[model samples]
Target: MGTFKIEGGHQLKGSIQPQGAKNEALQILCAVLLTPEVVTINNIPDIVDVNKLIKLLGNLGVKIEKIGKGSYTFQADEVDLEYLESDAFKVDGRGLRGSIMIVGPLLARFGKGYIPKPGGDKIGRRRLDTHFEGLINLGAKFRYSKEEQFYGVEADRLKGTYMLLEEASVTGTANIVMAAVLAEGQTTIYNAACEPYLQQLCKMLNRMGAKISGVGSNMLIIDGVESLGGTDHTMLPDMIEIGSWIGLAAMTKSELTIKNVSWNDLGIIPSVFRKLGITVEKQGDDIHIPAHTNGYEIQSFIDGSILTISDAPWPGFTPDLLSIVLVVATQARGSVLIHQKMFESRLFFVDKLIDMGAKIILCDPHRATVIGHDFKSTLKAMTMTSPDIRAGISLLIAALSAKGTSTIQNIEQIDRGYENIDERLRAIGAKIERVE
Candidate 1:
């Protein structure tokens, strides 16, 4: 496993362009199976998850051409159905939950799809009920083996219908949309996850001839068509990364410029950050942080009371970045409550920060009250292991902003999200190095 050795207490300067959204790119890659013609995709992230998905596609007989750096042409015109039954496919399928999306397109195009239990962050009970529930609404039958941990899906001309999802699941929504776009008749998805990633998926499907409305809201209306034509599209910039950079620039007092950020797509991020006293400047599609004067202050209520930051469904604060926000608040002033309503174990990493001398109260599994920047004189470095992707990056941010050196093992977790993180931080004057 590769590890990152970071020397803390440094100001990061220089501009870093955000990579394509890893979440969106993964689904887009799966959407290549919707058509048999060549589909060109641009702004692909050079990350581990994307690489695995590409390999999975190539195994299924899709032709991938490197038209240019960070650009590719995909043709699933000759996809072999037998490849779906291979152990190689299932092994890679177990790598991430995003792989579950292939079941929809393959079933739509070839009448059958096979997938193992999807794998991703072990944050909490992330159920596939939404995906299966939505697929069932379209007349697809699911067969699975609890012992073998395998799933087989088959259908002949899926018929769409109105369905209400149990919860707003991101991948579940994308998978259902992928399946519904090729099914016959119209499919109206209520309580849909209309996050930017899902919106990008909708736009891509619309470009490919699927009728979808309510791009940024909870209710999504999709008109199922007989086929989807191949089209060229670029994945949007990673807003989650942009938010992380905003948090990092504020905490470390770095004058960093995040380029190519879709500023208009930041629906609730800016307001969310401003509540924490972080001002983001829009410099022509770029977000600049002017060393965030006075670091970050936890803004309280009108009557001088601490505030609570929590997560909800779409149009609300994202649950993924709450860990980063919690970590950043540790370095800010005042006490604030972090209610991670989505995941149970996400905030468990705060104990590591407390070991580093930060003041915090772990109210329970899902809630914590943090009293910030009590100026624990110094944070001594230690050897630690990464838990998950977001929490891993949060720990990295905390370590970088702390004093002394720290060694973080299992950087593969962080690699799943952030691209060339160590190199990027090094360019921004951070004392960080990656070693195998």
Candidate 2:
């Protein structure tokens, strides 16, 4: 097992840069197989989830080359679809929610797609119904075996049509977009997820000759084409990481600056943190966090009452970031309720925070209320095991703000998203040591 021992209470004082987004890289990599030309992806995240996806693409006969740090040149022109039927594909597919996206691209190109169940954060049901329904709406046939729990999709030629997704599932929206990119006629997707990650995917597809409208909106329209040629595209900087950095800095009273952050893309994030009383200065592309020698005051509601920080679909605060926000809220002055509407089991980790002297009420599986200490009571750190990717990083933030040293086990969960997380934090003077 891998673990990270971090000594807390030291102010993070330095500049750090975010790696390319993990979610965007995963989607772009799968989209690579849709083209026959060389796809040069720059600023890709070198995280475990991406590594697993790269390996899966390699096994499928995609020629992958490491062009530079966090960059890759992928050539999936000769990908043998047969590899998708193998156990190796199923095993790799089980580790990521985005793996379900590959089926759409594979089916669009090869007329067939095969895979076992996809696995990721066990947050909730996370149904693939919308994804399958979208594909099925586009003239695709599906066959599933209950015993094997595997699915296969085939289509002679995908014909695009209008689709109203059951939910605005991020990966589901991405999957349908990939499948529709090569389908015949126009495809319109409503109730779409317009997150930054999905917008990047749309731009990447457009670079490859797919006509997609509504890049950052709930309605997406795609005009299918004969074939897509590859193009060089850079992955977006991870907003989630930036949010985590903001949380960590605020919780520890750190003087930190995150450089090269895509500020325009960070919609609603700034306002969301403002609710927590964290003041962030945008100096061009960098975000500045002054040392809160006097801790920031959490603002209450209209009647000077308590507030709740919850999550909804995109355009709302992301659920992937609620954990980090929750941990940061623990250090704020006022109390707030974190209602994790999307995932029923995401708030279970509050017990660990409560154990660390945090005033947290795990009201249920989906909701928790945190009473901030206002940096008065010192949090005594202890050994913790990471549960999910976002929760794992949130725990790291908590551990970094605690008074004593803490150990976080199962770094693979952490590795699935953040790129060079330890090194990046260390650059900002975080006392973290990785142990195997």
Candidate 3:
């Protein structure tokens, strides 16, 4: 119900820090349920989805203490398992997709798990089949209630085994890993999601006494342990946010330095932006995007064909960032086709950019071809509603570089991922105001 009034055409400068990775934090927070000991996590982002997950944990009787800013210690020694069946639990659990991750740990530790159908961005068909199948392979009985719209898994004792997932589902892999960490035998997962988020989760679980190997590869091996201990974990910077900043800087022709980006972990992201002809430089741990005053140009492939940017599984370009990439392409010198393969409906946001005077053709639900204006036309301000998290940020970037005032409604979608976005952008010389 909130809106952002952003006056465009401001040249933003100076450095800004990316928040903790929301996707990683979701998995890591759910891992707290694996151990009865105190688990302290730092660099937690203050975003709506993350906070909702934290509250959900508290509701499940995980003792949560906010030790400091962006830090929390959770001890789940006294959990209320029965609360999982309550109406309140269903309401909270259905609010965010990350809430579904708790099922893995709950089943691992308590031998039972329950989750209502999860909710998240309406980008595409995100299935829970991978999660349930992985658990079922690990000797857990799965049940789905059509009338109740809930999923429940139970087992007298889970026996771990090998499971090659249908796809390298990120959240699904994390869930299965958590469940396997406390099972009775060894478990092997092939074709797993080896993204930084999952890698960090595996590393943290190992530190907490979970016998896990293959931290950065698609195959993971886990041996069930009797118990887990307290551990400390720090999240990597949000790569999606970092990519958005790079797009924002390029679109507005501003010099920006994104701090503490963990450049080694940002595989293929910087290069992906550079392919769009944006100058991305590494300054120690920070990423420096120089102003594109003369405008950037999209580089064609070696065959002299039009550039095409598409998303893939790990190590490939992430689907979450195609929206930002699509928006940044609007100002580049050449045309590029943005293919969001994973999500069926994500490309629909191109209409809003088309309204802003960009030449874009939505080929289908998953593809869009953008012919960059190359600074020939300034995008005019307009009122728009944000459909999802990534689209909202992309629109915000377009608004910042637009010709006049732009109003973005449904900013709550934006807040679900970005932490204090308006305030942070203001610190860097952007004219943005948040109104209720």
RMSD of each: 1.4, 1.1, 0.6
Model 2: pairs clashing at backbone N, Cα or C within 3 Å: none
lDDT of each: 0.86, 0.89, 0.95
What are the TM-scores, per candidate, against the unseen true structure? 0.97, 0.98, 0.99
Candidate rank order under TM-score: 3, 2, 1
For residue 158, give model 1's deviation from the true position in Å: 0.5
Off by over 4 Å in 3: none
Give one digit per residue, the lDDT tens place, for model 3 in 1-436.
Answer: 9999999999999999999999999999999999899999999999999999999999999999999999999999999998999999888899999999999999999999999999999998999999999999999999999987999999988898988999999999999999999999899999999999999999999999999999899999999999999999999999999999999999999999999999999999999999999999999999999989899999999999999999999899999999999999998999999988998999888899999999999988988999999988989899999999999999999999998999999999999999999999999999999999
Residues forming the 10-long window of minimal summed lDDT in candidate 2: 88-97
lDDT of 1 by residue, 1-436 (tens): 9999989888888898888999899889999999988899999988888888898889889999998878999999999998788888778889877788898889888888889988888798877888887888899898898987998878988997999988998888898888988888888999899888889888988998888888888888888888888899998998889889988887787898999899877778878778887778889989888886566778998998789999887788888889888887887768889999989988888888888777889999999998888334545577778889988988888888888899999999999888888888888888988999
Stretches off by above 4 angstroms in model 2 are none
- Best-fitting candidate, scored by lDDT: 3
lDDT, residue 73, candidate 1: 97
- Candidate no. 3 TM-score: 0.99
Report the C-alpha lDDT of model 2 over 1-436, residue by residue, as the tens digit: 8899999989989888888988888788899989889999999888888888888888889999997887789888798877777777777777666778789999899998877888887677778788889999999999998876788889999998998988998888998999999999999999999998999999989989999999999999999998999899998899899998898889999888999999988888878898899989999999998888788777888997788778878789988899998998887888998899998988888888989999998888988888989988978899988998998999999999899999999988999888889988887788999999
User: Could you tell me the TM-score of candidate 1?
Assistant: 0.97
Model 3 residue 369 CA deviation (Å) reads 0.4
